[model samples]
Target: METLTNLESFVRSAESGSFSAAARRLALTPAAVSRNVAMLERNLGVRLFQRSTRKLTLTEAGESFLAAVGGNLESLQNAIAAVSADDGQPAGVLKISVAPSFGIGYLLPLLPEFLQRYPRVRPEWHFENRTVDLIAEGYDAAIGGGFELASGVVARTLAPLHVIAFASPAYLARHTLPADPSGLIDLDCIVMRSLSSGRIRTWNMRNAQGDEVIATMRETVVVNDPTAVREAARLGLGVAMLAVPDVLPELESGELVRVLPRWWADAGALSLYYPSRQLMPGKTRSFIDFVVEAFQREDYARRFAGSLG
Candidate 1:
Protein backbone atom coordinates (compact mmCIF):
# COMPACT_ATOMS: atom_id res chain seq x y z
CA MET A 1 0.00 0.00 0.00
CA GLU A 2 1.25 3.49 -0.92
CA THR A 3 1.52 6.11 1.78
CA LEU A 4 -1.51 8.42 1.78
CA THR A 5 0.80 11.45 1.51
CA ASN A 6 2.49 10.05 -1.61
CA LEU A 7 -0.88 9.27 -3.22
CA GLU A 8 -2.17 12.75 -2.40
CA SER A 9 0.91 14.40 -3.90
CA PHE A 10 0.64 12.29 -7.03
CA VAL A 11 -3.04 13.05 -7.51
CA ARG A 12 -2.63 16.78 -6.94
CA SER A 13 0.44 17.03 -9.15
CA ALA A 14 -1.38 15.20 -11.96
CA GLU A 15 -4.47 17.40 -11.65
CA SER A 16 -2.51 20.67 -11.43
CA GLY A 17 0.00 19.73 -14.19
CA SER A 18 2.94 21.00 -12.12
CA PHE A 19 4.58 20.30 -8.78
CA SER A 20 4.65 23.99 -7.90
CA ALA A 21 0.91 24.43 -8.33
CA ALA A 22 0.18 21.22 -6.42
CA ALA A 23 2.53 22.43 -3.70
CA ARG A 24 0.53 25.63 -3.26
CA ARG A 25 -2.76 23.74 -2.98
CA LEU A 26 -1.26 21.05 -0.68
CA ALA A 27 0.47 23.67 1.51
CA LEU A 28 3.86 22.06 0.84
CA THR A 29 7.00 23.14 -1.00
CA PRO A 30 7.54 22.19 -4.66
CA ALA A 31 10.61 20.16 -3.75
CA ALA A 32 8.62 18.23 -1.15
CA VAL A 33 5.90 17.33 -3.64
CA SER A 34 8.52 16.34 -6.23
CA ARG A 35 10.28 14.09 -3.74
CA ASN A 36 7.02 12.41 -2.75
CA VAL A 37 6.23 11.68 -6.38
CA ALA A 38 9.76 10.37 -6.95
CA MET A 39 9.52 8.04 -3.97
CA LEU A 40 6.14 6.78 -5.11
CA GLU A 41 7.49 6.10 -8.61
CA ARG A 42 10.50 4.23 -7.22
CA ASN A 43 8.29 2.08 -5.01
CA LEU A 44 5.98 1.26 -7.91
CA GLY A 45 8.88 0.69 -10.34
CA VAL A 46 7.36 3.03 -12.95
CA ARG A 47 7.83 6.68 -13.92
CA LEU A 48 4.63 8.60 -13.28
CA PHE A 49 5.50 11.94 -14.87
CA GLN A 50 7.38 12.93 -17.99
CA ARG A 51 9.41 15.79 -16.55
CA SER A 52 10.70 18.71 -18.59
CA THR A 53 12.05 22.18 -17.94
CA ARG A 54 8.73 23.86 -18.74
CA LYS A 55 6.04 21.28 -17.99
CA LEU A 56 5.17 17.88 -16.51
CA THR A 57 3.14 15.37 -18.52
CA LEU A 58 1.79 12.14 -17.12
CA THR A 59 3.12 8.87 -18.54
CA GLU A 60 0.75 6.07 -19.66
CA ALA A 61 1.12 4.30 -16.34
CA GLY A 62 0.49 7.57 -14.51
CA GLU A 63 -2.68 8.22 -16.51
CA SER A 64 -4.01 4.73 -15.75
CA PHE A 65 -3.08 5.06 -12.09
CA LEU A 66 -4.77 8.45 -11.86
CA ALA A 67 -7.91 7.02 -13.50
CA ALA A 68 -8.04 4.42 -10.74
CA VAL A 69 -7.15 6.60 -7.75
CA GLY A 70 -7.92 10.28 -8.48
CA GLY A 71 -11.71 10.03 -8.25
CA ASN A 72 -11.65 8.24 -4.88
CA LEU A 73 -8.86 10.23 -3.23
CA GLU A 74 -10.92 13.14 -1.93
CA SER A 75 -13.70 10.87 -0.75
CA LEU A 76 -11.23 8.73 1.16
CA GLN A 77 -9.65 11.80 2.74
CA ASN A 78 -13.03 13.28 3.63
CA ALA A 79 -14.14 9.96 5.14
CA ILE A 80 -11.06 9.77 7.30
CA ALA A 81 -11.47 13.40 8.34
CA ALA A 82 -15.13 12.86 9.17
CA VAL A 83 -14.27 9.94 11.39
CA SER A 84 -11.52 11.93 13.13
CA ALA A 85 -13.52 15.15 13.61
CA ASP A 86 -15.00 15.92 17.02
CA ASP A 87 -18.74 15.25 17.08
CA GLY A 88 -19.01 15.82 13.32
CA GLN A 89 -17.99 19.44 13.66
CA PRO A 90 -16.88 21.10 10.41
CA ALA A 91 -13.12 21.48 10.79
CA GLY A 92 -10.82 22.20 7.88
CA VAL A 93 -9.64 24.94 5.52
CA LEU A 94 -12.53 26.00 3.32
CA LYS A 95 -11.10 27.63 0.23
CA ILE A 96 -13.30 29.80 -1.97
CA SER A 97 -13.02 32.10 -4.98
CA VAL A 98 -15.09 35.25 -5.44
CA ALA A 99 -15.11 38.46 -7.37
CA PRO A 100 -13.41 41.31 -5.55
CA SER A 101 -16.27 43.80 -5.52
CA PHE A 102 -18.93 41.33 -4.40
CA GLY A 103 -16.62 39.65 -1.90
CA ILE A 104 -15.74 42.95 -0.26
CA GLY A 105 -19.11 44.70 -0.54
CA TYR A 106 -21.27 41.75 0.51
CA LEU A 107 -19.52 38.53 1.56
CA LEU A 108 -16.78 40.08 3.72
CA PRO A 109 -19.33 41.52 6.13
CA LEU A 110 -20.84 38.06 6.69
CA LEU A 111 -17.55 36.30 7.46
CA PRO A 112 -17.40 37.41 11.09
CA GLU A 113 -20.67 35.69 11.88
CA PHE A 114 -19.68 32.56 9.94
CA LEU A 115 -16.38 32.36 11.77
CA GLN A 116 -18.05 32.78 15.11
CA ARG A 117 -20.39 29.92 14.34
CA TYR A 118 -17.76 27.54 12.97
CA PRO A 119 -14.58 28.28 14.83
CA ARG A 120 -12.76 25.16 13.65
CA VAL A 121 -13.21 25.91 9.95
CA ARG A 122 -10.79 28.45 8.54
CA PRO A 123 -11.73 30.26 5.33
CA GLU A 124 -9.19 30.82 2.60
CA TRP A 125 -10.67 33.16 0.05
CA HIS A 126 -9.32 34.58 -3.18
CA PHE A 127 -10.84 37.75 -4.55
CA GLU A 128 -10.49 37.68 -8.33
CA ASN A 129 -12.56 38.26 -11.48
CA ARG A 130 -11.43 35.21 -13.40
CA THR A 131 -13.16 31.83 -13.39
CA VAL A 132 -11.10 29.22 -11.51
CA ASP A 133 -10.77 25.49 -12.07
CA LEU A 134 -12.26 24.32 -8.78
CA ILE A 135 -11.19 20.67 -8.79
CA ALA A 136 -7.69 21.22 -10.06
CA GLU A 137 -7.10 24.17 -7.73
CA GLY A 138 -8.71 22.37 -4.76
CA TYR A 139 -11.19 25.15 -4.01
CA ASP A 140 -14.15 24.24 -1.83
CA ALA A 141 -16.45 26.79 -3.53
CA ALA A 142 -16.69 29.75 -5.88
CA ILE A 143 -19.22 32.57 -6.15
CA GLY A 144 -19.87 34.53 -9.32
CA GLY A 145 -21.92 34.72 -12.52
CA GLY A 146 -21.55 33.23 -16.02
CA PHE A 147 -18.99 30.57 -15.13
CA GLU A 148 -18.75 27.64 -17.51
CA LEU A 149 -19.55 24.65 -15.35
CA ALA A 150 -16.84 22.04 -15.23
CA SER A 151 -17.64 18.35 -15.06
CA GLY A 152 -18.64 17.12 -11.56
CA VAL A 153 -19.46 20.67 -10.48
CA VAL A 154 -22.89 22.00 -9.54
CA ALA A 155 -24.25 25.49 -8.80
CA ARG A 156 -26.93 27.03 -6.62
CA THR A 157 -28.35 30.43 -7.42
CA LEU A 158 -27.74 33.02 -4.71
CA ALA A 159 -29.21 36.08 -6.42
CA PRO A 160 -29.79 37.60 -9.84
CA LEU A 161 -26.78 39.51 -11.13
CA HIS A 162 -28.68 42.54 -12.35
CA VAL A 163 -27.01 45.63 -13.78
CA ILE A 164 -28.35 49.14 -14.20
CA ALA A 165 -27.14 52.52 -15.38
CA PHE A 166 -26.19 55.27 -12.90
CA ALA A 167 -24.34 58.55 -12.81
CA SER A 168 -23.34 61.11 -10.23
CA PRO A 169 -25.65 64.10 -9.68
CA ALA A 170 -22.94 66.45 -10.91
CA TYR A 171 -22.47 64.41 -14.09
CA LEU A 172 -26.19 64.48 -14.89
CA ALA A 173 -26.22 68.19 -14.17
CA ARG A 174 -23.56 68.70 -16.84
CA HIS A 175 -25.10 66.39 -19.46
CA THR A 176 -28.69 65.86 -20.61
CA LEU A 177 -30.36 62.73 -19.24
CA PRO A 178 -31.10 60.21 -21.92
CA ALA A 179 -34.77 59.58 -22.65
CA ASP A 180 -34.08 55.93 -23.48
CA PRO A 181 -31.28 53.47 -24.22
CA SER A 182 -30.86 54.91 -27.73
CA GLY A 183 -30.01 58.36 -26.38
CA LEU A 184 -27.01 56.92 -24.50
CA ILE A 185 -24.91 57.30 -27.66
CA ASP A 186 -24.61 61.06 -27.09
CA LEU A 187 -23.32 60.92 -23.48
CA ASP A 188 -19.88 60.03 -22.20
CA CYS A 189 -20.28 56.45 -20.99
CA ILE A 190 -17.69 54.84 -18.75
CA VAL A 191 -17.43 51.24 -19.92
CA MET A 192 -15.70 48.13 -18.63
CA ARG A 193 -13.50 45.90 -20.76
CA SER A 194 -14.14 42.18 -20.57
CA LEU A 195 -11.27 40.43 -18.81
CA SER A 196 -11.76 37.18 -20.69
CA SER A 197 -12.55 38.58 -24.14
CA GLY A 198 -10.37 41.69 -23.97
CA ARG A 199 -13.07 43.75 -25.69
CA ILE A 200 -15.09 46.74 -24.60
CA ARG A 201 -18.33 45.27 -23.25
CA THR A 202 -21.55 46.38 -24.95
CA TRP A 203 -24.53 47.31 -22.86
CA ASN A 204 -27.51 44.95 -22.98
CA MET A 205 -30.66 46.68 -21.76
CA ARG A 206 -34.29 45.59 -21.51
CA ASN A 207 -37.43 47.72 -21.33
CA ALA A 208 -40.50 47.18 -19.17
CA GLN A 209 -42.15 45.28 -22.02
CA GLY A 210 -39.18 42.85 -22.04
CA ASP A 211 -37.84 44.21 -25.32
CA GLU A 212 -34.06 43.99 -25.39
CA VAL A 213 -31.69 46.37 -27.18
CA ILE A 214 -27.93 46.48 -27.43
CA ALA A 215 -26.83 50.02 -26.77
CA THR A 216 -23.60 51.45 -28.10
CA MET A 217 -22.12 54.43 -26.30
CA ARG A 218 -19.31 56.91 -26.76
CA GLU A 219 -16.63 55.82 -24.34
CA THR A 220 -15.16 58.55 -22.16
CA VAL A 221 -13.24 56.24 -19.82
CA VAL A 222 -12.63 52.52 -20.14
CA VAL A 223 -11.83 50.47 -17.06
CA ASN A 224 -11.23 46.79 -16.47
CA ASP A 225 -12.71 46.54 -12.97
CA PRO A 226 -16.38 47.09 -12.05
CA THR A 227 -15.47 49.02 -8.88
CA ALA A 228 -13.34 51.40 -10.92
CA VAL A 229 -16.26 52.12 -13.24
CA ARG A 230 -18.45 52.93 -10.25
CA GLU A 231 -15.80 55.25 -8.86
CA ALA A 232 -15.42 56.96 -12.23
CA ALA A 233 -19.15 57.63 -12.33
CA ARG A 234 -19.11 58.83 -8.73
CA LEU A 235 -16.36 61.32 -9.60
CA GLY A 236 -18.66 62.71 -12.32
CA LEU A 237 -16.47 61.32 -15.09
CA GLY A 238 -19.36 59.71 -17.01
CA VAL A 239 -22.41 57.51 -16.86
CA ALA A 240 -21.73 53.82 -16.15
CA MET A 241 -23.50 50.48 -16.18
CA LEU A 242 -22.74 48.56 -13.00
CA ALA A 243 -24.07 45.67 -10.96
CA VAL A 244 -26.85 46.74 -8.58
CA PRO A 245 -25.24 45.03 -5.59
CA ASP A 246 -21.93 46.78 -6.23
CA VAL A 247 -23.38 50.30 -6.21
CA LEU A 248 -26.16 49.71 -3.70
CA PRO A 249 -24.53 51.80 -0.96
CA GLU A 250 -23.78 54.69 -3.32
CA LEU A 251 -27.27 54.59 -4.81
CA GLU A 252 -28.93 54.54 -1.38
CA SER A 253 -26.67 57.30 -0.02
CA GLY A 254 -27.42 59.64 -2.97
CA GLU A 255 -23.87 59.51 -4.33
CA LEU A 256 -25.24 58.06 -7.58
CA VAL A 257 -28.68 58.36 -9.19
CA ARG A 258 -30.43 56.13 -11.71
CA VAL A 259 -30.13 57.15 -15.34
CA LEU A 260 -32.74 54.96 -17.05
CA PRO A 261 -34.83 53.46 -14.31
CA ARG A 262 -36.93 51.24 -16.59
CA TRP A 263 -34.02 49.64 -18.35
CA TRP A 264 -31.65 47.01 -16.85
CA ALA A 265 -29.14 44.40 -17.96
CA ASP A 266 -30.08 40.88 -16.92
CA ALA A 267 -26.77 39.11 -17.07
CA GLY A 268 -27.37 36.00 -14.95
CA ALA A 269 -27.51 34.83 -11.36
CA LEU A 270 -24.77 35.06 -8.78
CA SER A 271 -24.25 31.45 -7.79
CA LEU A 272 -22.33 29.29 -5.36
CA TYR A 273 -20.52 26.46 -7.13
CA TYR A 274 -18.87 23.35 -5.76
CA PRO A 275 -17.89 19.88 -6.78
CA SER A 276 -20.70 17.31 -6.78
CA ARG A 277 -19.18 14.89 -4.34
CA GLN A 278 -21.26 12.01 -2.93
CA LEU A 279 -19.98 12.94 0.52
CA MET A 280 -19.33 16.64 0.88
CA PRO A 281 -16.99 18.03 3.50
CA GLY A 282 -18.71 19.26 6.65
CA LYS A 283 -17.23 22.73 6.24
CA THR A 284 -18.58 23.07 2.70
CA ARG A 285 -22.04 21.79 3.62
CA SER A 286 -22.26 24.19 6.56
CA PHE A 287 -21.18 27.15 4.47
CA ILE A 288 -23.80 26.44 1.82
CA ASP A 289 -26.50 26.24 4.45
CA PHE A 290 -25.35 29.40 6.20
CA VAL A 291 -25.20 31.47 3.00
CA VAL A 292 -28.58 30.26 1.80
CA GLU A 293 -30.16 31.07 5.15
CA ALA A 294 -28.56 34.49 5.26
CA PHE A 295 -29.81 35.33 1.77
CA GLN A 296 -33.33 34.33 2.76
CA ARG A 297 -33.19 36.33 5.99
CA GLU A 298 -31.93 39.46 4.27
CA ASP A 299 -34.19 39.11 1.19
CA TYR A 300 -31.12 39.81 -0.95
CA ALA A 301 -32.79 38.51 -4.11
CA ARG A 302 -35.52 41.13 -4.01
CA ARG A 303 -33.23 43.88 -2.74
CA PHE A 304 -30.74 43.27 -5.57
CA ALA A 305 -33.34 42.99 -8.30
CA GLY A 306 -31.98 46.13 -10.05
CA SER A 307 -35.30 47.90 -10.04
CA LEU A 308 -35.68 51.62 -9.27
CA GLY A 309 -38.49 52.13 -6.86
Candidate 2:
Protein backbone atom coordinates (compact mmCIF):
# COMPACT_ATOMS: atom_id res chain seq x y z
CA MET A 1 0.00 0.00 0.00
CA GLU A 2 1.18 3.52 -0.76
CA THR A 3 0.88 6.43 1.66
CA LEU A 4 -1.44 9.17 0.49
CA THR A 5 1.17 11.72 1.55
CA ASN A 6 3.69 10.14 -0.81
CA LEU A 7 1.12 10.38 -3.57
CA GLU A 8 0.73 14.03 -2.68
CA SER A 9 4.46 14.55 -3.32
CA PHE A 10 4.10 12.98 -6.76
CA VAL A 11 1.18 15.27 -7.49
CA ARG A 12 3.15 18.34 -6.39
CA SER A 13 6.00 17.38 -8.70
CA ALA A 14 3.57 17.02 -11.58
CA GLU A 15 1.97 20.42 -10.89
CA SER A 16 5.27 22.30 -10.63
CA GLY A 17 6.85 20.37 -13.52
CA SER A 18 10.23 20.29 -11.77
CA PHE A 19 11.26 18.26 -8.73
CA SER A 20 13.31 21.14 -7.34
CA ALA A 21 10.43 23.61 -7.67
CA ALA A 22 8.06 21.14 -6.05
CA ALA A 23 10.56 20.61 -3.22
CA ARG A 24 10.54 24.34 -2.56
CA ARG A 25 6.74 24.31 -2.52
CA LEU A 26 6.57 21.42 -0.06
CA ALA A 27 9.47 22.66 2.09
CA LEU A 28 11.16 19.33 1.44
CA THR A 29 14.50 18.48 -0.09
CA PRO A 30 14.49 17.52 -3.79
CA ALA A 31 15.97 14.11 -2.91
CA ALA A 32 13.14 13.50 -0.45
CA VAL A 33 10.54 14.38 -3.06
CA SER A 34 12.21 12.07 -5.56
CA ARG A 35 12.31 9.27 -2.99
CA ASN A 36 8.63 9.71 -2.16
CA VAL A 37 7.69 9.57 -5.83
CA ALA A 38 9.94 6.56 -6.42
CA MET A 39 8.44 4.76 -3.43
CA LEU A 40 4.94 5.53 -4.66
CA GLU A 41 5.78 4.17 -8.12
CA ARG A 42 7.19 0.94 -6.66
CA ASN A 43 4.11 0.39 -4.50
CA LEU A 44 1.72 1.01 -7.42
CA GLY A 45 3.80 -1.25 -9.73
CA VAL A 46 3.93 1.49 -12.40
CA ARG A 47 6.39 4.11 -13.53
CA LEU A 48 5.34 7.73 -12.89
CA PHE A 49 7.67 10.28 -14.45
CA GLN A 50 9.70 9.77 -17.63
CA ARG A 51 13.10 11.21 -16.78
CA SER A 52 15.88 12.47 -19.04
CA THR A 53 19.06 14.48 -18.52
CA ARG A 54 17.43 17.88 -19.05
CA LYS A 55 13.78 17.28 -18.16
CA LEU A 56 11.15 14.97 -16.67
CA THR A 57 7.65 14.27 -17.96
CA LEU A 58 4.73 12.44 -16.41
CA THR A 59 4.10 8.94 -17.69
CA GLU A 60 0.61 7.55 -18.39
CA ALA A 61 0.04 6.42 -14.78
CA GLY A 62 1.04 9.78 -13.27
CA GLU A 63 -1.41 11.67 -15.48
CA SER A 64 -4.30 9.38 -14.53
CA PHE A 65 -3.36 9.48 -10.86
CA LEU A 66 -3.31 13.26 -10.84
CA ALA A 67 -6.76 13.44 -12.42
CA ALA A 68 -8.06 11.13 -9.68
CA VAL A 69 -6.19 12.39 -6.62
CA GLY A 70 -5.36 16.09 -7.12
CA GLY A 71 -8.67 17.43 -5.82
CA ASN A 72 -8.59 15.05 -2.86
CA LEU A 73 -5.08 16.20 -1.90
CA GLU A 74 -6.20 19.83 -1.99
CA SER A 75 -9.19 19.01 0.22
CA LEU A 76 -6.92 17.17 2.66
CA GLN A 77 -4.64 20.20 2.91
CA ASN A 78 -7.63 22.47 3.48
CA ALA A 79 -8.88 20.18 6.25
CA ILE A 80 -5.52 20.32 8.00
CA ALA A 81 -5.45 24.09 7.79
CA ALA A 82 -8.99 24.27 9.17
CA VAL A 83 -7.97 22.18 12.19
CA SER A 84 -4.77 24.18 12.74
CA ALA A 85 -6.60 27.51 12.74
CA ASP A 86 -8.68 26.77 15.82
CA ASP A 87 -5.81 26.58 18.31
CA GLY A 88 -6.33 28.99 21.23
CA GLN A 89 -2.69 29.81 21.35
CA PRO A 90 -0.47 29.40 18.34
CA ALA A 91 2.47 27.00 18.60
CA GLY A 92 5.08 25.47 16.28
CA VAL A 93 7.28 27.20 13.72
CA LEU A 94 6.59 30.27 11.59
CA LYS A 95 8.81 30.83 8.56
CA ILE A 96 8.91 34.49 7.53
CA SER A 97 10.92 36.52 5.01
CA VAL A 98 11.99 40.17 5.14
CA ALA A 99 14.43 42.59 3.55
CA PRO A 100 17.94 42.60 4.98
CA SER A 101 18.06 46.23 6.14
CA PHE A 102 14.57 46.12 7.64
CA GLY A 103 15.46 43.06 9.67
CA ILE A 104 18.70 44.48 11.06
CA GLY A 105 17.63 48.08 11.51
CA TYR A 106 14.12 47.43 12.81
CA LEU A 107 12.85 43.92 13.48
CA LEU A 108 15.82 42.39 15.32
CA PRO A 109 15.24 44.21 18.60
CA LEU A 110 11.53 43.37 18.78
CA LEU A 111 12.39 39.70 18.20
CA PRO A 112 13.67 39.28 21.75
CA GLU A 113 10.37 40.45 23.10
CA PHE A 114 8.24 38.60 20.58
CA LEU A 115 9.96 35.30 21.29
CA GLN A 116 9.63 35.87 25.02
CA ARG A 117 5.92 36.70 24.73
CA TYR A 118 5.10 33.39 23.10
CA PRO A 119 7.48 30.76 24.28
CA ARG A 120 5.87 28.06 22.16
CA VAL A 121 6.18 30.03 18.93
CA ARG A 122 9.36 29.33 17.08
CA PRO A 123 10.19 31.77 14.30
CA GLU A 124 12.50 31.01 11.40
CA TRP A 125 13.25 34.42 9.96
CA HIS A 126 14.93 34.69 6.56
CA PHE A 127 16.60 38.09 6.14
CA GLU A 128 17.83 38.57 2.61
CA ASN A 129 18.02 41.20 -0.11
CA ARG A 130 15.74 38.99 -2.19
CA THR A 131 12.06 38.10 -2.33
CA VAL A 132 10.90 34.49 -2.03
CA ASP A 133 7.90 33.23 -3.97
CA LEU A 134 5.88 32.78 -0.76
CA ILE A 135 3.67 29.90 -1.86
CA ALA A 136 6.45 28.04 -3.64
CA GLU A 137 8.78 28.45 -0.65
CA GLY A 138 6.05 27.50 1.88
CA TYR A 139 6.62 30.70 3.85
CA ASP A 140 3.96 31.46 6.44
CA ALA A 141 4.22 35.22 5.93
CA ALA A 142 6.61 37.83 4.54
CA ILE A 143 7.27 41.54 4.94
CA GLY A 144 7.68 42.92 1.47
CA GLY A 145 8.09 46.23 -0.39
CA GLY A 146 5.92 47.91 -3.09
CA PHE A 147 2.18 47.69 -3.69
CA GLU A 148 1.20 45.26 -6.43
CA LEU A 149 1.08 41.53 -5.66
CA ALA A 150 -0.67 38.41 -6.94
CA SER A 151 -4.43 38.58 -6.35
CA GLY A 152 -4.46 35.44 -4.23
CA VAL A 153 -2.05 36.91 -1.70
CA VAL A 154 -3.21 39.13 1.18
CA ALA A 155 -1.22 42.14 2.33
CA ARG A 156 -1.58 44.18 5.52
CA THR A 157 0.39 47.38 5.67
CA LEU A 158 2.62 47.53 8.73
CA ALA A 159 4.15 50.96 8.15
CA PRO A 160 5.61 53.24 5.55
CA LEU A 161 9.20 52.98 4.35
CA HIS A 162 10.01 56.40 2.91
CA VAL A 163 12.83 56.42 0.38
CA ILE A 164 15.33 59.20 -0.27
CA ALA A 165 18.68 59.88 -1.86
CA PHE A 166 21.66 60.70 0.27
CA ALA A 167 25.42 60.82 -0.25
CA SER A 168 28.27 61.13 2.18
CA PRO A 169 29.16 64.75 2.91
CA ALA A 170 32.60 64.32 1.40
CA TYR A 171 31.21 62.94 -1.86
CA LEU A 172 28.71 65.82 -2.07
CA ALA A 173 31.45 68.41 -1.43
CA ARG A 174 33.51 67.01 -4.33
CA HIS A 175 30.76 66.35 -6.90
CA THR A 176 28.68 69.46 -6.27
CA LEU A 177 25.02 68.64 -5.59
CA PRO A 178 23.01 67.96 -8.73
CA ALA A 179 21.59 71.28 -10.06
CA ASP A 180 18.25 69.49 -10.12
CA PRO A 181 17.01 65.92 -9.65
CA SER A 182 17.99 65.06 -13.22
CA GLY A 183 21.61 66.10 -12.84
CA LEU A 184 22.38 63.08 -10.62
CA ILE A 185 22.51 61.09 -13.85
CA ASP A 186 25.78 62.67 -14.90
CA LEU A 187 27.60 61.53 -11.73
CA ASP A 188 28.63 58.06 -10.64
CA CYS A 189 26.14 55.96 -8.70
CA ILE A 190 25.91 52.65 -6.87
CA VAL A 191 23.13 50.47 -8.30
CA MET A 192 21.06 48.29 -6.02
CA ARG A 193 19.92 45.10 -7.72
CA SER A 194 16.23 44.30 -7.24
CA LEU A 195 16.05 40.80 -5.87
CA SER A 196 12.34 40.15 -6.49
CA SER A 197 11.93 41.37 -10.07
CA GLY A 198 15.56 41.00 -11.32
CA ARG A 199 15.08 44.42 -12.96
CA ILE A 200 17.74 47.05 -12.58
CA ARG A 201 16.50 49.33 -9.76
CA THR A 202 15.89 52.87 -10.87
CA TRP A 203 14.68 55.99 -9.17
CA ASN A 204 11.11 56.72 -10.21
CA MET A 205 10.87 60.48 -10.71
CA ARG A 206 7.65 62.39 -11.14
CA ASN A 207 7.20 65.62 -13.09
CA ALA A 208 4.69 68.38 -12.22
CA GLN A 209 1.99 66.63 -14.31
CA GLY A 210 2.36 63.58 -12.00
CA ASP A 211 3.78 61.40 -14.71
CA GLU A 212 6.57 59.14 -13.46
CA VAL A 213 9.78 58.46 -15.30
CA ILE A 214 12.51 56.00 -14.39
CA ALA A 215 15.90 57.59 -13.86
CA THR A 216 18.65 55.29 -14.99
CA MET A 217 22.14 56.02 -13.84
CA ARG A 218 25.49 54.86 -15.13
CA GLU A 219 26.35 52.27 -12.48
CA THR A 220 29.86 52.67 -11.16
CA VAL A 221 29.23 49.86 -8.66
CA VAL A 222 26.71 47.05 -8.49
CA VAL A 223 25.97 45.61 -5.08
CA ASN A 224 23.18 43.37 -3.72
CA ASP A 225 23.76 43.85 -0.01
CA PRO A 226 21.93 46.88 1.41
CA THR A 227 24.56 47.55 4.05
CA ALA A 228 27.34 47.45 1.46
CA VAL A 229 25.57 50.02 -0.70
CA ARG A 230 25.21 52.40 2.24
CA GLU A 231 28.84 51.79 3.14
CA ALA A 232 29.85 52.67 -0.38
CA ALA A 233 28.00 55.96 -0.08
CA ARG A 234 29.46 56.58 3.37
CA LEU A 235 33.03 56.14 2.15
CA GLY A 236 32.41 58.77 -0.53
CA LEU A 237 32.57 56.19 -3.33
CA GLY A 238 29.36 57.44 -5.00
CA VAL A 239 25.80 58.56 -4.50
CA ALA A 240 23.69 55.64 -3.31
CA MET A 241 19.94 55.44 -2.78
CA LEU A 242 18.20 53.77 0.13
CA ALA A 243 15.17 54.02 2.40
CA VAL A 244 15.01 57.31 4.27
CA PRO A 245 14.73 55.85 7.74
CA ASP A 246 17.86 53.81 7.11
CA VAL A 247 20.22 56.79 6.81
CA LEU A 248 18.67 59.16 9.37
CA PRO A 249 21.43 58.64 11.91
CA GLU A 250 24.07 59.58 9.38
CA LEU A 251 22.05 62.63 8.42
CA GLU A 252 21.85 63.83 12.02
CA SER A 253 25.57 63.25 12.57
CA GLY A 254 26.37 65.16 9.36
CA GLU A 255 27.99 62.03 7.94
CA LEU A 256 25.49 61.87 5.09
CA VAL A 257 23.47 64.65 3.52
CA ARG A 258 20.03 64.39 1.99
CA VAL A 259 20.38 65.26 -1.72
CA LEU A 260 16.99 66.82 -2.46
CA PRO A 261 14.51 68.00 0.14
CA ARG A 262 11.32 68.10 -1.93
CA TRP A 263 11.54 64.85 -3.86
CA TRP A 264 10.90 61.56 -2.06
CA ALA A 265 9.80 58.07 -2.94
CA ASP A 266 7.64 55.87 -0.79
CA ALA A 267 8.48 52.20 -0.32
CA GLY A 268 4.78 51.87 0.77
CA ALA A 269 5.48 49.56 3.63
CA LEU A 270 7.09 46.63 5.30
CA SER A 271 3.85 44.66 5.12
CA LEU A 272 2.74 41.30 6.46
CA TYR A 273 1.73 39.28 3.41
CA TYR A 274 0.33 35.75 3.25
CA PRO A 275 -1.62 33.51 0.92
CA SER A 276 -5.40 33.83 0.58
CA ARG A 277 -6.10 30.31 1.80
CA GLN A 278 -9.47 29.96 3.54
CA LEU A 279 -7.88 28.87 6.77
CA MET A 280 -4.56 30.41 7.74
CA PRO A 281 -2.50 28.47 10.28
CA GLY A 282 -2.82 29.89 13.81
CA LYS A 283 0.90 30.67 13.82
CA THR A 284 0.44 32.78 10.71
CA ARG A 285 -2.40 34.80 12.24
CA SER A 286 -0.52 35.22 15.50
CA PHE A 287 2.58 36.56 13.76
CA ILE A 288 0.63 39.10 11.76
CA ASP A 289 -1.06 40.38 14.89
CA PHE A 290 2.21 40.45 16.77
CA VAL A 291 3.90 42.54 14.10
CA VAL A 292 0.98 44.91 13.67
CA GLU A 293 0.52 45.35 17.41
CA ALA A 294 4.24 45.77 17.93
CA PHE A 295 4.36 48.58 15.40
CA GLN A 296 1.41 50.33 17.03
CA ARG A 297 2.87 50.40 20.50
CA GLU A 298 4.41 53.80 21.16
CA ASP A 299 7.37 52.41 23.03
CA TYR A 300 8.12 49.91 20.28
CA ALA A 301 8.10 52.63 17.63
CA ARG A 302 10.46 54.76 19.73
CA ARG A 303 12.79 51.83 20.22
CA PHE A 304 13.43 51.44 16.52
CA ALA A 305 14.19 55.19 16.41
CA GLY A 306 13.75 56.18 12.77
CA SER A 307 13.60 52.64 11.34
CA LEU A 308 10.13 52.02 12.70
CA GLY A 309 8.67 51.87 9.23
lDDT, residue 105, model 1 = 86
Q: Please report, as a residue range, the 10-residue window in candidate 1 with the lowest summed lDDT.
A: 80-89
Among all candidates shown, the one with the greatest lDDT: 1
The digit string of per-residue lDDT tens for model 1 on 1-309 reads 999899999999998899999987776789999999999999999999999999999999999999999978978887866663436588778899999999998888999999999999999989999999887777889999888898989999999888899999999998888878888899999999999999997778998787787777888899999999999999999889988888989988999999988899888998999988766778888889989999999898988888543
Decoy 1 TM-score against native:
0.89
Show the lowest summed lDDT stretch of 10 residues, model 2. Answer: 300-309
True-vs-predicted CA distance for residue 79, candidate 1, Å: 1.8
Task: List the candidate 1 regions with Cα displacement exceeding 4 Å.
Answer: 15-17, 24-28, 39-50, 55-75, 81-86
Question: Once superposed on the true structure, which residue ranges of model 2 sit more than 4 Å away at CA?
Answer: 1-4, 42-46, 120-122, 169-224, 248-255, 267-269, 298-309
User: TM-score of every model?
Assistant: 0.89, 0.76
